[model samples]
Target: MALYNKRINDQLMTNCLALSNELLEKETHSFFPNIMSYWNHILFGDLILLRRLALNHIAGLTPQTLSALPTPKSPQDIYCRKLSDFAHLRSQVDELIIQYCTNLTDENCEQFISYTTTEGESITKVIADLTQHIFNHQAHHRGQLTCVLSQFGVNYGCMDLPIIVSEGSRANA
Candidate 1:
C-alpha cells in the first residue's frame, strides 16, 4: 500500500512539474498567476494537514491553514517563486508517507483521521482516502492550468498515470 501511494506521490509531483515547465517554455506566465495561487494555497494546506496528522493534532488547524497562505502581488512572480516551494512540499509529503508507512499494517488502511476542515466542518476520513484526495486535488488544478495554457496556444504534455511511473520521477539533482 505504501509503495502504491509513494508512486502516486512521485507521479503527481512529476506531472505537476512537467506541466508547469511546459507553461514556462511557452511564456504562459499570464495564464499561470491565478491557478498558481490556488495551487500553492492547496499545497500549503496539504502540508498543514500532514503536519497535524504527524503529531495527531487534528483539531484547531483549519483556521491556521486558512490564515497562513502566502499572498503574492504578481502572478508571474508567484509562478517563479512557488515551484521551488512546491518541490519542497512534495518532499515533505514523501517524508510523511515514509513515516506513516512504517507504522502501517493492512488493518490500518482505514485509520481514522478526524479534523476541522478549512470550511469549519468537522471531518472524519480514512488516511487512504485523504492521501488520494491530495493527489486528486493536485491533478484538478493542474487541469485548470492546462486549460489556461491551451488558451495561450501552448500545450501541456501527457499527464496520464502510466506516463508518470514509466518515465520515473527520480529525485532531480
Candidate 2:
C-alpha cells in the first residue's frame, strides 16, 4: 500500500535520526577516531543529498557521471553539523511527503520527477526508483557505520528496519 510504504519511509527516516544520535553518543567512547569520522561523513553526505532532493532537484546526479565526495577529516565537528542539517532536511522531507502523499495516485508513484543534481549533471528517474535509492543509500552507509561501531565493540542494537518497525509500532506507528 502507498500509505504503508510512506509510513515505512517515515519510520526509516526516524530510525536514521535515532541511529545517528545513538552513534554520536557511542562515538564519544570510540577507540577509532578515523572510523568515527568516516561514519559521520556517510550520514552527513546522505543528509546533504536528501536536502538536495528536497529542493525538487534531480534527486541525485553528479556533475560528472561519477561524483567523488571528499574525504572526512574530523568526526565531532562533522557529526554535529550534519545533525543540524539532517534535522532541518528531515523536517522538510516529512512535510513534503505528507503534503503530496495524498495526491500521489497510482500513476504518480511511477511518475518521474526530473531535475538536475547540484553537480550540474542531469538525471531523470521514477519516484519509486529514487525513493528506493534513498533508503538503500542510507542502509549502505549505516552498514559501514555498524562495522565501525562493531570494531570498537559498540553494538548497534536495533539498527535494522524490521527492528525499527516493530519498535515504531509501539511508539509512533
Best by TM-score: 1
* Stretches > 4 Å off in candidate 1: 1-33, 57-104, 167-173
lDDT comparing candidate 1 with the true structure: 0.53
Best lDDT goes to which candidate? Answer: 1
lDDT of 1 by residue, 19-134 (tens): 55445444445534554464554455456555545545332223343333333323222323455566665565555555555665555556787877655679888866775665
TM-score of each: 0.54, 0.48
> Model 2: per-residue lDDT, tens digit, 51-84?
4344553323323311233222332336434444
State each model's CA lDDT, in order: 0.53, 0.47
Task: Report the lDDT of model 2 for residue 15.
Answer: 42
Question: What TM-score does model 2 achieve against the real structure?
Answer: 0.48
